[model samples]
Target: WARHGIMTTNLAEAYNAILRKLRPLPLTAIVEGIMYRTTMWMRTRRAVTLQQMSNAQTPFCKKMAEYLQEKANKARFHTVITIGNIRQRWEVTCRTKGGFGSSTGVITHEVTLGHESDNTCSCSCNKPKLLHKPCSHVLAACAKIKLDSTSYVSTFYLKDRVLNV
Candidate 1:
């Protein structure tokens, strides 16, 4: 737009808004403000790149659409809590021995599988703080199913939460 000279009156107003906010400052203050906003923009761009890389699916753009759809379905958002075994049936349990100690209380957890945006559980435990790393409970589930303990998920996206809500 700038190359085509399609400038909008709002551009001046936007700059004015920033100037207005820093009107009482000295020269250094204005420079600092510009540098701060520039740094913020750069950081935002880098975060976007990292998130895109983490979320990339296989087979290029073709699979990318389906991968996004799967993510949209929010199929990976739920954490399976085993209360206990049920005589050949499925059982759920939430107890464990580890960072919280051997006799810790029932540790309820919120797992996020699909939604990448809000993909964090609010537990102070060592598990989710590691980000995408499986915790002890996930490890247990993987063992029960004879799979890699790290395969279990612990976070979700908007789709699952919205539907389940």
Candidate 2:
């Protein structure tokens, strides 16, 4: 559970319930029941993914896009600076005030883009590490370069990837 980052017992309880029901059935019946349930789950997920893809967005992407939009709005006054000719490194500075009548403070973060094939990126805030998604700073840099935000997203969040799984 720790390896999978699961902090709740809901999944365990569900599995136990399923097992309890299946225990009364014959071997073949139990196998069939589990298989049917799994198939239905996969089918339902695939159908939803297809619907989302038709709209040109996966559920993950849509959620991340919303988060990025909110963060971008808050970061309206921030600036993005290109590091070099590589076009893979950028610096983003976010300005914030402690409180009313307080002096403004600046926090700078670096975003490093991944290889072209992967289309992934990371930021100094470590959000990408925890969430497995691009941070706000990375999105802000992408906006500055007029780059498509989706292009930097990991394929793991894509509909095609989910379908393939």
Candidate 3:
């Protein structure tokens, strides 16, 4: 299954609280303070990411790498089977997992690979196209064919792109 990141209004509420504290200040001073704070945040992020990149082997940023690894770990719980007449098309079925947070039952997805050497992957979940990252289904299908799933991942989450910020 694909993981969906939920972003709520808590961030805007926090920002509003900060702005309320600055409401009595002059508009020019408030704007300058916000700009300076944002600049410092970027600087701090860049420095920390630079250190993380130094020890990393993959091109993906640290978070992205961990996310992909989690997907791969989930992929191991899936059983992929070659379906239809095409070898590139596979059926990825989730194994029965019993736990407090597990799904109701086994679920299956259709994954079609347009090419073996390219990143053209279409899943029933449509996560790769929607999120620009390989979902567990894609990873399972790729593993069945001994293909690398990283090619299907977007470069936007790469270390180089994050470092450029």
Candidate 4:
């Protein structure tokens, strides 16, 4: 799951459940049932995607942004330090509590913004690689600079790109 970034096996479970119900049906009946289910699934999914496009952010991106915002709010002791003459790099240090009664700790991460020609950025957390989305550290640095965090989000999570897919 980590290698493929699959968070769950719900799709496989659903397919297995459908197979169990189709086992006692005739061949043509099973085929018709599958076709009907697939058609309905596609229609419902397309409608939801279109509705999400009406918002400022895509559904997936909006959910990620909300999570980042919640984490940023808890990161009250965090600091964003810019580097390089052109400010192409940022070091974000976030202090977090360990547990209910444990001591606090500091975690530092580096985020690199590519040049205008590249239009790319990366975070040391590697969340973008795993989830194909911007990490909280990157969002925190962007917030410090008063930049739009959505600009850093991957195009795959954007409404237009998702719809195209």
Candidate 5:
């Protein structure tokens, strides 16, 4: 924002100064440091509230919101489900969206199912694209069918790994 001239040098300097005090710390320390800074800064506002934070209507705030939304949009999912009898089969699902105009925009999904006898999931997402946990969609589907979703989740994978990767 400073480079784009959207913010003044003085404002950038203040942010940098606070960051300097935070940069040398470990991840947890840096998070706590920033949390303290945020508390102090909000205290100066006199009327800060959850509504105010949620209502960040400035252009910069909107851009930040869009960026975070993009990050969340890139998550992947994997899981096992009871398809026949008491037998379990693995499934993988991926989601992606692209395009400009509403008419041209499209949301794409690729889902794969695994065979128990072969110990393989048929979805492309199940290959080198391994996810750390079952997606909520799979969990929801299981719940809708009165099945235990937890039994399908592998303890080794987390949403963050599936999302970040």
Candidate 6:
């Protein structure tokens, strides 16, 4: 997936998997079947999104929200040290994880506030630079500094953007 920091040719593979059941059907029948399935999926997803909005729970479209939450959970095990520099730098140490294995048994990353007015933080892990999503280190730094971690998230992951699409 895009959030995992790399995109590959799996899209065509996924489409091929979707086309498996339609193989025996005529061309028109296959096209109609795909359309019907796509329509149903869209309707169901839209309904779910509407329900989420009604309940005041849709922070982001479900998948991105879950991904962010998983990173937030990891933030709890982080030790964020403010570096107090011009760039508002921070050192985030992973106490319970080995994102990059270290001989000392703790992984650390340097995080800095982005140049933009919006608080788009970046990490030494390079995930934010690559995937357009804040890595756990950035999230941890934001948490320590009382910044809203969500502000660092890419607009591509925003719920409103997804809904409009």
User: Against the unseen true structure, what C-alpha lDDT does each candidate score?
Assistant: 0.43, 0.73, 0.82, 0.69, 0.42, 0.78
In angstroms, the error of model 2 at 124 is 0.9
Best-to-worst ranking by lDDT: 3, 6, 2, 4, 1, 5
Ranking by TM-score: 6, 3, 4, 2, 1, 5
Off by over 4 Å in 6: 1-7, 57-59, 95-102, 129-131
Q: What 10-residue stretch in candidate 1 is worst by lDDT?
A: 154-163
Q: List the residue pairs that clash in candidate 4.
A: none
Candidate 5 lowest-lDDT run of ten: 156-165
- Please provide, for model 2 over 32-60, each residue's C-alpha lDDT reduced to its tens digit, 9 standing for 90 to 100: 98899899999988886666676753345
Q: What lDDT would candidate 1 get against the real structure?
A: 0.43
lDDT of 1 by residue, 8-118 (tens): 556767777867877678989988998998778767655544445444442122323344445324323323454434311112236444436435544554432322244
Pairs of residues clashing in candidate 2:
none
Model 4 collision count = 0
Q: Score residue 127 of candidate 5 by CA lDDT.
A: 23
Superposition error at 85 for model 5 (Å): 11
lDDT per residue for candidate 6 within 79-108, as digits (tens), equals 989886777899888864553466778877
| Two-way lDDT contest, 3 vs 6, winner | 3
Q: For candidate 3, list the clashing residue pairs, or say none.
A: none
lDDT top scorer = 3
Q: TM-scores of the models, in the given order?
A: 0.30, 0.56, 0.71, 0.62, 0.25, 0.72
* Residue runs of model 2 more than 4 Å from their true location after superposition: 1-47, 57-61, 71-75, 85-87, 96-103, 115-118
Q: Which stretches of candidate 4 lie over 4 Å from their true place?
A: 1-41, 56-77, 97-104
Q: 1-165 in candidate 5: lDDT tens per residue?
A: 353223455875886686997777798998898899887775654342322444535212333335333433433232334444444442323333454434545332233323323322233333212442334444433433565433333432222222222
Worst 10 residues of 6 by lDDT: 50-59
